[model samples]
Target: MPWIRSHITALLATLLVATYAAATEPPLSLRAVTAENNEPFNIVFNGKLQGLGVDVANEAARRSGFSLQTEALPWARALETARQKPDVLLFTVARTPEREDWFHWIGPIAKREVWLWRLRTRKDVMATSLDQAKQYRVGTSHNDAATEYLLAQGFEQGLNLDITMHDRAIGYKLLASRVDLVPMNPLSIGAFARESGIPLEDLEPQMLLISSGGYYLALNRLSKAETVAKLNAALVEMKADGSLQRLLEKWQPKGSKARSPSSPP
Candidate 1:
């Protein structure tokens, strides 16, 4: 009787473990996506997604005990699809107030600043304030949250704003005087300029557009709340263990690099 009682207890423990594992194990694979050609954040390297954002997401998913299947999509498409779909993973996203309530947010995975860059050679072009800078032709990336933030601040296109395919291309447009000004961040701007044969010293941050914001791993509004919680927990652990810091450093650029992005809290 005693042996049977002990055996029943053992069986109960095994069943409990199985149930917990089932509850916590992530789905076979989750569809993950990041903006196409948005380097240092999301980009295909050697035919695979391998950027700071992708690396961080992969680690977070691993810590959470799941696997992430990543895809590269254009900025606009990535945003729209993630907005409409569920359980889809979108990362390295800047958390904005206009979009605060839309997604199930998970992190301050990274930090970046969106600033207005102007040609240093253009002495005739100087603005002490954003309003003064608004008078010139400004180039921005399509669907970039920084652009949206500017829109919220009354930056108008055609009249003054020029939407471009790539935010980094704005640097080229500026060098050619195609646009008087452009909006970009430090993380990839230097590389963008180098690739375009434009000197980094030629451009300078003229205005602090978005002081600072956290880039997050955002889930669609329709995602399971439990799933969100699981991802968040894994991320919290990452931050606690210093893996997050290491990931940031791994993506940190070397020579001919732009400004370094600060760590998010």
Candidate 2:
């Protein structure tokens, strides 16, 4: 009977220790999602992740005292995974009413502009007006915000093209007079042009269509609310102390043209 009593006490002590350890330890892991093909934002380089989204996520994790692990997946797949995983986060997401209920958003950590580019040789299409642009066909990437926004604005004459190879083809298409305009994100276009040795003078944004759109870090609704709140507080602190802006500027492409003050209406 004494041996039985000693065993019971030992088991109770073990359980108590386990409970205390669980209560005191921070979450062991955090998952983040990013597009497999997004460059200058989120991309894999020589078996490691690099880009603005990666930088922002790393900083957020450091500030929040958590370990972050990333998985490169298709944009849709990444978003879906984040939606289903309780401890997952998604980076560089654009907040929209359509997505408001899908996840808990933590920031507008970065901003980007949507612009229309055309070959300098085509001065007619280069004229500063969306109405004038309507006279010719435009090329845009599939499943992109620029495409959706343009279509919503009644620009029906557009060619859907794959984003990965669009830059290589855009200049040639414009030079050949096959497409009048190519709408793209400014940072991406600049990065593509530089990496491919295409001169910016050869392909420049004819008009800055949208001034700014915010990018966010999103947490799955199933994630612990306390964790999400702590992360948000860290992000706010980063912003207040200018760490966020400094990080973004560090990754911003060098000599990238600022949005032109005079943009086409």
Candidate 3:
């Protein structure tokens, strides 16, 4: 009996020591980037990065025991950075067919649709189809998924597509009648308009461009496979435990529905 009791005490002490060691370990640090002025998703407000995309990325990193440092850059630069740099993460990216293999995707964090928006006052601008839309000048962010899609459809820059470095510029261009149309998400219209000091009622949806696939946290393909797996597992856990849904609800405006379940594109 005495020998059995001594063995049990030793095992307990070993377990405690192991737990303490694990608790004292520091998290791995990671670098992440997103497009500048992507309101409600990847916003840089008051010199701080905090938005739905930021919140989701931060939570996923925390759950995976990684410390993430996020930076906001022009859309094109962010995409290029994530493409060429090893171990970098990009968030709020659409997982289009053209981009499926560009990175190791971690999530379908939020759903969104891309539409062609025009000024209500511009009664002369009308686009009922992609071809009809092509006849009019449309503004887009540089290297954005919408821009890539449009280009693939035979849209040429400096012809019908007016590309800007910042996503915020698209809204302003449309308001000023500089561009007859702009591709954007309807959900972000209010926030985007507010950023440009324009009324949401001024812009009207003309045509829907992209409605499939969702936003994801894209990790550089050159990153460690184990790290990608850990971040993905964290997102899966968040989905299963309703934390992802809660986060969505917290960020989404009232009366909006949240979709937390979906397969990766």
Candidate 4:
């Protein structure tokens, strides 16, 4: 009877230690980079960083008992942070074949359609094919996945493509007829145009470029798998509970509606 009591006492001690260890462990700490003015997804307004992506990341952190730290930076530098820092997260990134291996991905946060847009005034700006479109000047960003996609398609910089760091720059250059066309996502094209003070109607979608993928929250590939797994599980629950859907609906730009389920491409 004494031996049996001792065995039970040891088993109870083991369970208590395990529970204490789990509770005392530090929560996962994450670094996230947000594009400075990529509205509706990530934006700083009234000096506060806010957007659908912002809300999603914060909610995931809370659900997983993780701590989230975010910084607003230019897209170029943000790309560097996501690539180089494990545990750092990037959002609204297109999950393309070229980017599938870059990060541990979560959520098709938004549906996206990349388009070649040109001014309605320029009748010569239209191109029926990407190759034909390549014959005209196109504004793209350096190290951007879209730029990489175009380059892989045989577009050469300077010869027919002009690369820049600012998304708004492309829109402005196109308005001045500096670049004949620029790639834009339908979800944010109007915002970009409006940011540049260009009337939305002045821009017309010409060639519908890549539209097969949507944006995702990506953790650096070197991130701890267990931590990433917890965050992803939380995100999956959000999606199933329609929390993710509601976030999209809440942040959708005026005039355009959020898709019932975001369409790929």
Q: Tell me, by lDDT, which candidate is best.
A: 3
Worst 10 residues of 2 by lDDT: 157-166
Error of 1 at 142 (Å): 0.8
Candidate 2 lDDT, 1-265, residue by residue in tens: 9999999999999999999998788855787888865667887889888888888888888788787878888777787888888889898776655577988888888775777887666667753677766666777655556666667667774343223234556556656777777776666767656554667677766776765546788988888998899889989999999998888787766666533424442
Candidate 3 ranges beyond 4 A from true positions = 1-15, 253-265
Clashes found in each candidate (C-alpha, N, C closer than 3 A)? 0, 0, 0, 2
TM-score of 4: 0.84
User: Residue 166's C-alpha lDDT in candidate 2?
Assistant: 47
**Candidate No. with top TM-score:** 3
Give candidate 4's whole-model lDDT: 0.82
TM-score of each: 0.86, 0.77, 0.87, 0.84
Q: Point out the higher-scoring one by TM-score: 1 or 4.
A: 1
Cα shift from native, residue 242, model 1 (Å)? 0.9
Off by over 4 Å in 4: 1-27, 256-265
> If both were scored by lDDT, which would come out higher, candidate 2 or candidate 3?
3
- Residue 120, candidate 4: Cα error in Å is 1.8
Q: Model 2 misses residue 52 by how many Å?
A: 1.3
- For residues 189-252, write the lDDT of model 3, one tens digit per residue: 6776777677766767777788888889998888999889999999999999998988877777
Off by over 4 Å in 1: 1-27, 256-265
User: Lowest lDDT 10-mer window, candidate 4?
Assistant: 256-265
